[model samples]
Structure formats: C-alpha cells, structure tokens
Target: MTEGNRMFIQDKRSYSRLLLMLLLLTALVSSSTRAVVHAAVKVPDTIRVAFFINLGTKYQSLTPVATLQSANGLNLIWRDPQTGISAGTIAPGQSVRFAMDGYRALLLETTDLGAAIAVLKKVQASSNAAFVTQLTKSGKTVYQVTEGAYSTAAQASSALTKWTNAGVAAGVQTLLSARVAGPWAVEAGSYASAAEAASAAAQLGNAGLDAFAALKPQNGTLSYVVRVGQEKDATALSALQQSVAAAGFANARIPDAVEPYTSLRTDMTLNGSANKPVTLYAIPSGPSTVLRAEPAGSGGILLTERNKRTYRGSMEMSVLNQSLAVVNEVDYEQYLYSVVGAEIGSKWPLEAQKAQAVAARSYALSSGMGFQIANVVDTTTSQAYYGIGYENANATEGVNQTAGEVMTQGGKAINAVFSANSGGITADNAIEIWGGDNSFLSSAVPSPDDGPQKGLLDWYYVALPSGQTGYIRSDLLENSGQTHVSGAKYLRVTGEGTAVRSKPQVVSTVEPVARVGTGTLVVQLGKVAEYSDYSWIEDPMTPDQLLTALNKRAKSPITGPLLTLEVTKRGPSGRVTEIAANGVPVNVGAGDNLRGALNSLKSTLFSVEETGRYTIVDGNGTVREVPSQSGSLQVIGGAGTSGSLPASNAFFMDGNGNLRAVTTSPLFVFSGKGYGHGLGMSQWGAKAFAEQGYDYQYILKYYYKNVSIEKGA
Candidate 1:
C-alpha cells in the first residue's frame, strides 16, 4: 500500500472496534466465554510500612517494589519516595515492582496474554525464582534489549531465542548502531559510522581522547573523564556525593580521586574568641559564604547542617586578595563606632549613639555583609539613631551629600543607556561604559558604583588596545554612540607604558574606571577610590577597591530601624534595666546626659509591656484582686550599665555600658527584641552582621551567651 493510504487506513480504525474484535477473538479461542476480567487492586491509605524482609543495603532512598497476598485480586503498593504514590493500572510488559531487599516483586502490570498466563503459573516464592519457573517453562519471549551496539544487540537477541526455544520465556529487541569501543570517552559509545571516526577525531581534536580505529589498545583506551573540577578536594568530593544523594541521584558515583591544586590556607574564627577552631565547609566560587559563631566560652556549635542559619562572630572573608584573619565582632563594631563617631562628633548623646552604632553594625554583620546600613546620626548631639535618628521613622532626611551627587551623575549616564524615562540605575540593570570620543566598550553589569567604587564616579569611555579615555556627562547626552565593541576588550597606550597588574591597585584602578572592557562584569573588587579634577576612578586589580565597589550594590540592609520602647522609670538608679512596664534586659544605647539616656532607651528598646493593663488572677480557692497600674512593671537590678551587661538574659545597663542583673531575682514580665529569639545573633541576624563587619564569629559570641572557646574535634 502507498504510504499515504496506509496512514489513512490506520488512522480510520477506532480503539473501541479493536477492543471488541480482541474480546470476540478471546471468546472464540476459549472453550467457554467468561465476562471480561476487571481485576480490582486494593490500594492502602497510608502506604508507609516496615518490610518483613531485611534490606542488604542500609539505605534505599526510593522504594520501588512491595509484595502482598491476592484474595479477590493482588493488593500491591509501589511507592517511589521521589515520585510519591502510584496506584492502579498494571499493563502487561511494564514493571510495577521496584527494589526491595535482595529480591524483586513480579510486577502485576502486563498486557501480553502469554506473559500474564506465565505470571499466573509462578509459585508464591521468591519473585525471580517463581518467574523463572513459570515463564521459562512456557517457551515464550517475555523481555527485550535494544538500542546499543549491533554486536551486543545480536548477542542478546540470539540468547533470547535460545532461551525461548529451551522453554524459558523471554523478550528480545534489535537495534542499529556502529560497534565502537569506549567506556571512558564521553563519545566513545556514540558513532555515525565506522568511516566517520576520522571526522569525529578531527572534531575532538586536543580535548584529551582522539578518535582511533577499532577501539585499539583496550587497556589503554580507558575513558578519560573530568571527575571533579578545581573547586573540590577528596574530602569535599565525599561530601558532594552525599549532597548529590540527598538531592535524589542515589545511584550516581564519584570518581575515586582528583589532582590537587595550589591550596590556600582558610582560617575561620567563629564567635569572638579565636581560641576555638572552626571546621571548614566546602567553599564555593561565589563571593563568600556567611558563617556564624555564638558567645565566647559557649561550647562549640556546628552550623554545617544544610539550611541551618546562625550568627557569625568572625569570618575568613574572601575577596580578590588573600583572606585576612580579623578581630572579634564587638571590636569590629567598636571600630565602626570610632570611625562614624569621629566623622560626626564625640559629644553628649553622640557617645551614647556610639553604642547604638555598635548594635547596628553588630546586627548587620550578623546577617551577611551583603547589605547597606544607613546610619542616621543626630548631628547636634553626636548621637546616631537608625531609621528615626536624623529625621523620621523612614529616614527620608538621611542623605550622604557626596554620595547623592555621585548618584545623580550615575543616573544621568544610565538614563542615556536605557533611555530617558528609565528611572535611576539599579543593581539589576546592565551598565555599559564607553571610552574616549564616545565609543562604546564592555558589556553591561547589574549595578554601578559598588564597594571599592563607592566614592568613585563612573562614566562612559572608548577603549583602545592599550587603555581607554572618555568624557562623563552631567546631563543627558543629545547624541550617544550605539555601536558595540567587538572581540576581547583592549586598552590603548597614550603616553608612558602603563604597568599591567593582574588585578586592580590602590592607585591606577580609578583612572581607568571609565575604560571597562567587554567582559568586565563590575568594577574590580577591593580597590581604593581616587578622585582628581571632577572625575572619580578605581584601581581594577586592587582587592580593596573591588570590595568597596561591590559594597555599593549591596542593598541587603544590615541595620534595621533603631528599636525603641518608652519606660516610665529607670532601673534602680538612673540606669535603665527593662522598660518601665516590662522586664526584658534587652540592648540599651547610652548617651552622656539625661536626654541622651532617654534617647538611647527610645532607639534600642525592642518591645514594650503596658503597665496599666489588668492581670488575670487565678488561684486555687483564693480570689485576690491586684490594681491595674502595676500590670506592666519591669524589675530593676542594683547593677546597671551599658558595656558590662550580660550578653544574654536580664542585665542592668548603665550609661557607662556596665552589665548588671546577673540573676533574675525579681521576675519582670515584658516583651522585648523584635524577635523573642534575642539580640546579638539571629540567623537572619547573622546575614545582617556579615553586611557590616561582624563576621560569623562575632555573631556566635553575641548570641550564644558565655561558655568557652576551644578546639572542636
């Protein structure tokens, strides 16, 4: 028949007619006619059950098979942990059984009448044994193997025929493919034809294995594989395997070993004290991984479990430069206070502002050093408040005069690229830079003016083979170039030969900032900004400058609005312990004067308790009524100061930062800290901390209360 007519005739047939014919055929073949079988299989509600048989392997992530007795019909459960529950429909020739222990369950699904009859004949013993006796004894084909090398397929088919003739039922398949030899080569098993080996060899070229005639030198032709990349070591490979299994690739295997690279020492200081050593987790190629540490002396806590978040006291922060071991979280906070305090002033409320500043820095650093902290200081008192500091709760008034100007300029340049009504430059937008004479160079990036480039202003420039030069615009350009640069970015040499370093430097990264090339993602990490004339630039290879530039794009906020609550009275003396209504010795800022003290309380109080609310009195046979006025009383302790307060629990904080309230003698009821989880190190808090300078170690020490830092096994 013609191809078109064959297709039409085949398409015209209906499935209902086919089923009717099949039923009539079956009835004619049988001596007596019986109703069409509709075997109903019972499915269980909760399919999770312990097996009576022992599994040789300790763990099987997937349950592929189960066995049950057949009363009216067979009751079987096939649960694929990865795919959830599957019930009904056991078509002939398809496997419903998955792996149990050492055995397989004869799958109930099959459409083949012969195979079904064989399955019915099998005894109720081991599935494999029963299947062999029932199917093999019947002299029929029941399985298949196809789609590999022709030689292998032929061998399988012949074997199947022999088994079938010997009264052992089996199925076989035939496939077409050139026979080639390779187990290691990714393309070893694949082939167009034997004659195409040379072309394949030319294609492979120098990527390790070259195609050879006949899989020559079987021993030498072992597959060459890139087992693991430079990012992993032997220990890491094992962990990676575990992760892969947990991710559902249980059958996957890792290569035995890999070549080593020039390793760098990664020192970790989690929590404040360096006395305790931290275990190193596998490092990724990303910017950095955030870690957390609890209070000093607090017995070691491991944050290695997947998805478990914690605070970090110290970190082995990674940038372009070799990592540096740093000071405690508190010290970092102190350094920030000193810098900002010096920038603003060291006066009455300013001193108190420093404590709050420390708190803010600590909080941000705990999270992850990927956020921006807008510290709004009370310039008059030298005291800094968070959201409500300089202006209102929204910090609308907080503005960095220098940064604002740079932003305005950046906005104009970006508007030129994305078009006029494009709004301002965001970290998600791609930024392209041009060189001298309005020539475009480099691909776009997510954000402009990041970390190291924070202070430096960016502009378009035309790049040359040696370097680049260009003009920056304050207003929208009437005619901007739209031509794209081709090939790898090249710099042009103007006067003297410029020194070429692998990365940005403190000096030169700035001058060439406008000359970013095609592949330049963002300004180099960790270079200092230098300003000259009316232009700002960065050192490309300088680690400091790059870090500074990256920091600019960080919108993840480290410090939240200054938490504050009002208290009617001071703790014991003029010092504040808990709010007047509730007793939660939370972090309290300090100022030099009374107003400063009150301001500290206002900015730092996490939550407050209502003192005027009535307290329900429930006693056994005792009915007593208490006045509503004392409903919210926060108990005060004799010892109270800012600096010396206990890291955890209730502690009196005086103006000098002294920690008092060693024990909770008089219980005080209260609500405090945005989270009942406490201050210093929230896992969310840890990400916040890294945003500032508080590394993982600092976060750990801040939250975990006192213990001891020692080497962990």
Candidate 2:
C-alpha cells in the first residue's frame, strides 16, 4: 500500500516540475523576441554615461546603481576582462561600479548578421580599424567600429570622422572601458596651488584653448598642472602640442607621463575647526532618513535646520564666515535634480524642465568657482541647490533624460545664463552687460510682434528748432523738413509738437508726466521698444529720501537734495542707461545692479512724476481739491485731507521744511515696467513658448541665437 501511494505522489510532482520548466522556457523565448523587436525600432545609442553617486568623494557607493538596475529589471554583470575572473553578482544596495570613466564608440547599423559580417570584412580590408561584436538588449547583433582606442576624447574625436566617412551609417556610443595608462599631455602651465592652476586654465579657455587643471604628483608632493590636452600616443600628442602652440601658446609642450589622479577624496571633513576635531562621514542621509547632527563631545543629537536634506553624494563642512557651511559633492546630473526644481517649478511643462536642465548643466560645467572642491555653491549665487527636499519626480526624470548633455559653442561649453523673465526680448551680451560681442549670446525677439513694423514711412534723424536731435517718423515731420536729414549716425528729433512717450504713441499712458516733453531726441538703439506685458511700479521719495538712497548706493558721494532727476541716456530697449541727480551724472550699472541701486525701481524703463496738486475724495461722495498754486488751503468735506485721498498723494513739505497741508496730497510718482536684467532665456517666456506647443530645443534656439543642442558627455 505504501509503495503504490509513494509512486502516485512522485508522478504528480514530476508532472508539476515539467509544467514549470516549460513555462519558464516559454517566458525566456518571449522576452528574447520582445528585446529583438525593440532593438529594431529603437534609436541608436549616442552616449555611454557613467552615473556617479558622489562626485568629489574618492569612495562612491554603487548602491544607487545597483538599486536603479534592480528596480528597472536590468541584468548588469561586472567582471575583470584581463583575468577573466568573476568578481561577484552586483546586487541591490551594493556599491561596486565606482569609476566614472568611459570612451565613445561608433555603432554601425546592419540589416542582418550577413550585412554586419560584410561591413567588418570591408573595414578590415580598407583600414586597420578595430571592431567589437556584441548583441544589443533587443537580441540584435551589431558591430562597434573604432579607428583606435584613445586615452582622451580629443584624440577619439579626431579619429571619429575618418571611420564614419568609410561608407557606413553609424552613431557615437559611450562604452565603459579602462583608460590606457599615459603620461603625455600638452602642458599649459604648472602651479603650486589649485586656485592658481584654475586661473591659468580659465585664461587658456578664454583664449579659445580647451584646458583643465589636473593634480599631478611631483617630488613627494602634489602640484596642480594646467593641461590643454592629453593624448595616449606620440603622434596625437605631437599634433596637440603643435595646435596649441599655433593658438598662441608658444611654450606648449608634451610633458612626460604622470600617474592619473581621481578628483574624489577618501574621506570628507565636516566643520573642521582649530578648536574642534574634523568629523568624517561616508554619505548623507538616505531619502527616507531624517537628518540629525551629533554634538562634537556630547552624545546628544541636534536636528538639522533642514530636516529632509537628503543628498546623493558626500558632504564636507567647513568654517566659512565664522559659520558652518556644508557643501554637497554630488554627481553632475544628481546636482541638477535639486537645482531644476529650485530654479523653475517642478510642475512646469516637461519641455521647459528639459530646457532648464540643459541650461543648468552647461552653466555648471562652465563654472570655475569652487573647482578645487565642489565646483559650485549651494545658493542662488550659482544655482539654488536645496538638496533632495526640493527634488521632485518629474524634475529627476528630466535630469536623467538629459544626462551628460550641455550646450556647446565652437566645441566648448557655452555660458548658458538664464533669468526669471526677459520682458519680451532678450539682450545682446555685448550691448547690454559685459560689453563684448559673443556671437551665441545675441538679442532675440521672444515675441512674434517684436518683429519690425510694416507699412511705416522711413524714419530720419533731424534737428528740431529747440536744438534736440532724435529720429522722427516721416509722417510726423512738418513740410519745412528740408528734404529729410541725410545719413546721420544718431536719430534726431524733428517737428515742433512731437514728444517721446514711455511707450509707442498708440495705447501709451495719457499722463503728460509719463511722456518726455517735446524737443527731447530719440535714437533707434534696437528693434521697436514696445512690450505689451510691460509692468508698472510706483516708488515716491522725498528730496531728503532721494538724497539718502543715492548716498547709500552711489560709488561716489551724493550730497544735498535732488534738484532734478533726468535720464540722460537710454539703451536700445529705451531703458535708462544714464541718469543725473542735482547735475551729478551717474552711469547706470549693468544687469541687476541697475535695479539694486534703487531698491524700489523695478526696471530701468521708467518715468518720474512730481505733482504739487491733489484731488481728495471723502466718504459721503463729497470731494475737495487743492489747486497747484494753493498756499494755505482748508478742506471742506466729509473727512479732512488727512483721512481722505489715496496714499499715493500723501502730505508734502515745502522748501522751508514746513508741512504745507495736513491732508494726503501732492506726492511724487515713479512708474515703470519689467523685472530683473532682460537677458538670455526668460523663464516665463519659456513657459509661454511651451504652452504654444514649442519644444525646449526651439525655445532655447530662439533665445540663444546660432547655438546647437547635441548629446554630450
């Protein structure tokens, strides 16, 4: 009886096992088929990205990488190619792949295995190109064709053109390969400190040379060397040295091979002070972990000011400005995860977020500040970085999708600056701010209406009867025009009654105070200076108040009261470029400083109004008014002048410091529009463009004229 029961149970178990094996085989086949189909339709890989968990720290925990692969069901195998020995399985929460070094390869596409074999044969016959065979995730076989393995990107790029032109459709891809040991580099200079080396590198970059500061070990100590280029082979090295020499570096020479050093350090110090010992930690708190700092001696814990300050990298704290400053040294892309949200709203359109990510990445790469350690600040001075608390899902996604991407001009990172808004039009870097023509940074019309006006008669510069010179529309000129003034550099004001309004004549403010009186000339600095979204703000200051503000901000002393306020010079946007107070000429500062000087002034485009008369309206629908020439007047209304009238028209003091009226009346009005320095890609303008169905690339192209957006490393 026992033998029969055991045989029946064994047969049932065998049937179950066979069924499970068949199901597993079917799933495996289905997965392989799906991968092949996906590979066929997928775009060719352009980059091989090495995601770093901590940027500056010598030790990087591969936990994030493992976690990412596991979460995405990706099978990643790590082994030593030389020894052919298996290290171990890279499981979730383990840190293994720490090095952020890779090389770019060209992936050649083929219709089938036969086609790939044919290309490989042609490559071997035509040239000594190296080709690697591998199957893609989609189970499609492809060949990675390379001219030669190089130590530096410059050498790789120099060789890419030759292989691509060999009659093959190929795309560049990044591969995780060991760097060939090399010491040869085009040396620009060597410095005793990192700061000096960085300065030299910047100078070389300014001169259009690609240079970077590298730490080299010399005579038992480390020295910072400014390297213009690094090549593995002698031929490439010689070519670089010659090119740099031709580019004004007469002393550029190939230096002997030096051992490469990693920028990451072993341990990071936190709040190291003479009085207190250095505190070292491996990583910051995880996303779910609450942040708490322990006292130096006491075991007691103090909650961090920012409790949810999760960071992807390590941190170092130092005593800066007599206060503890913590710097988060994180991967370039992870840094942008926090930055994109802080700079622009996380809820912004995906395209807008992508644009911001690219701009932020370019900005960070071009930055030289803190290059010795973190490379950037955690505040608005660089880009407002609030760590993981400010990071959102969408923002992180944007950062991941645009990983390693940056804006480039002439094969180098461009200074991609952006602001909250451009006030409808962007400014040329040369004309508005730094005063040097950057072809990539030019004035761009963000609005369609900003284009030139049509059906308008020719404009001519003319001298008016009152001696004012400005451009006058042909229709506004009188018959006594004497055949429109010929070929003048500056536009001249013509006709007897023409005046310069704050905006174009149509839809302009009706207040006479808002318009520059007749006789003041106007020049065409740029396109028509009119913005429909122009804003207005009022800031009234008494003679004494104006004197106090001017004295506080002016580089030179501003004494006495303001006898007169006049805008002596204006920019192309009609923004005041120069102003005079009490006959003292003050050159308006560029960019944000223009508004910082006068805290109340929103923008340089403004008008000042002084009124000596006031109309007071009381509660009971009764009104009483004071004439401009009134000396001592008594209000006869429901409420006295003190409680009646708007705050804009408050009390005023006579020249003798006497309170002329006890009612709200006679106040100066300052009306203006816009905010911030109108330059580069405007945040609001980007949002508007995105809403109009324009992609981030189009928005960026519109603002940054003549710039290309390409996949970068």
Summing lDDT over every window of 10 consecutive residues in candidate 2, give the lowest-scoring window: 264-273
- For residues 239-354, could you state the per-residue lDDT of candidate 1 as single tens digits? 54454344333543543222111111111112112222211222111222212122233221111211121212221111111111111132332223332333222331222232
| Residue 632 Cα positional deviation in candidate 2, in Å, after optimal superposition | 8.1
Count of backbone clashes for each model? 134, 17
1-713: candidate 2 lDDT, tens digit per residue: 69999999999999999999999999999655322111111111221111212333432212110111121121221111122211123233221111111222343533244444445555557543334332221233233333333435565565555555555433323232222322244776557776787666666655544455654444544566667642344667777777677767787767654333222111111111111211111111211111112122211111133343444443333222211234444566777888898888777788788888888877777664433334565655466777667889878887787776666677666678876656556655555554656677657464432112224444433333333222344455334323323222233334555653323334334532222334444433222322233444243456676666666667787766455555676666665666677557865445345565555465555666544444545457865554433344444444644333433323334444332222233334455655556667777777767768987777777777666565663
| Candidate 1 wrongly placed segments (more than 4 Å) | 1-225, 228-400, 404-573, 577-667, 671-713
Per-residue error for 244 in candidate 1, Å, reads 19
Candidate 2: which stretches are off by over 4 Å?
1-310, 319-325, 370-373, 447-546, 600-602, 611-668
